[model samples]
Target: MLANADHVMPDELKFEGDKAFFFAALDRADLIVHGRNSYEDQPNSPKRRRIIVTRKVGAVARDTENPNATLWNPHGAAFEAARAQAGVHTGTVAIIGGPDVFDMFMDRYDTFFLSQAPRVRLPGGEPCFDGVPARSPEQVLAAHGLKAAESIILDPAFDVSVTAWRRDNASSAARR
Candidate 1:
């Protein structure tokens, strides 16, 4: 997400580097999980398999319109079951998000790729994560045990950068 300094949703924010990185990651992954709103906003790509998390549905069901997609209500089915239903046996599962979906996998993510466009700011837009008040994306991810590992300036002209964070087990253990 190319959010502003306030960490609000970047509505229709388009960054070429971001798009390239996202699609490349999707290409390598076997399953993509995202919130309903996110799924709806994204353009249809039948080549990749997807699981759209939605509260409106009561069960996991294959999308009739898209053979590569599945509608999953996490309240009704376990994550593993949903993946199985989507025919994903073993492979990388990318969590593309809305705040709620990101929050749901807080502890499960081995790594997080955070991209930001510091020049842009969406004051009233939605946040990247829910239930966290007045926190930066890095702060939120750090609270969940991830530590910044590498930072890359994807576009120097726009001050757009991508930071990769990995789970810090030692820090987490120390906290306990």
Candidate 2:
């Protein structure tokens, strides 16, 4: 949840501490997935395979600028097919999301890394999750049967921290 309450991710919300933590994690992912509006902040990372979820494309289409990226529409094409189109046959999938994209993958994530900048508050800005502001992001995650791991402080200077959420064995079994 990287935006303000108004569902807009303003430029001012980007925190350097969060980026360091986020980019490092992205390095371990085989494929990155995000909504059209949600993009990787690193522009220089070369050819990172990704899927851009969008409504503009009927199902799946090649991204104009990046050959490693495929535009996918959930309503038109199955996510499995899109993942394949992104050239990731197997390995971990990373979701860097906007609220709708996060909501779409509720059942599929093995882990969710939620980072917060405690000192910065966007009163009328976007919520991390769609149900946020109404029910906190933590509440939404709990409702989805995800258990939180210990929170780690990423950057003390900016007061940024991250928590990892994973479904318990029982919850995973139920999901399967």
Candidate 3:
């Protein structure tokens, strides 16, 4: 998510470095999980395997238009089962989000790359996490026992930065 210092309205992020970083991660991931809204927003994303989380039940199937995509209703199916159905047995799964999705995977994330554009502010935009009381994404991650590693300045001209929050006790298998 690309947000201002306030971490609001992450909908219209257009930072080149942020996009590059996200695509780089996507390139390395075997599966991608995201909310319905996020999936709809990225209509032209490269043809990679993806699972779209939704509340409606029994709609889990490969997208007819996009063969690499699946519509998953987690309420009706287990995550492992969904992964297996997607033919992803072992490899990195990147969770891109809407706030609810992020909150759902809070405990499962071994590392979260939070990109921020300090110069931009979206006062009424949606937050990174919706219901969490934490003031910032860092606080929310910290609550889940993740600590921030050194931040990378993705774009010095725009004061854009990406901070990685990693779980201290995450098992080696989880890292894989």
lDDT of 3: 0.75
> Which consecutive 10 residues in model 3 have the weakest lDDT in total?
1-10
lDDT for each residue of candidate 2 in 1-176, tens digit (9 for 90 to 100) = 47765666666657677788788888988998898677776764556898999998999989988888899999999998998788788888889888788989987777888887777778777677877788988898888878799788878887788999998777666664
The whole-model lDDT of each prediction reads 0.78, 0.82, 0.75
Runs of candidate 1 exceeding 4 Å displacement:
1-12, 40-44, 131-133, 169-176
Spell out the clash pairs found in candidate 1. Answer: none
**Residue 7 alpha-carbon offset, candidate 2, angstroms:** 5.6
Off by over 4 Å in 2: 5-12, 43-46, 173-176
> Which ten residues in a row are the worst by lDDT in model 2?
38-47
What TM-score number comes out for model 2?
0.89
Question: On a 0 to 100 scale, what is the lDDT of residue 104 in model 1?
Answer: 87
Q: Write the per-residue lDDT of candidate 3 for residues 60-134, one digit (tens) a residue.
A: 777676678777887788788778778899889999887877888888888898888877766556678754333
Candidate 1, RMSD to the unseen true structure: 4.1
Question: lDDT per residue, candidate 1, 1-176, as tens digits?
Answer: 33445543455466777777777777789999988666423454677898989876797988888898888898999888889989998888899887888888888887888887877756666677764447788889988888899998877888888899888776545543
User: Candidates' TM-scores?
Assistant: 0.85, 0.89, 0.84
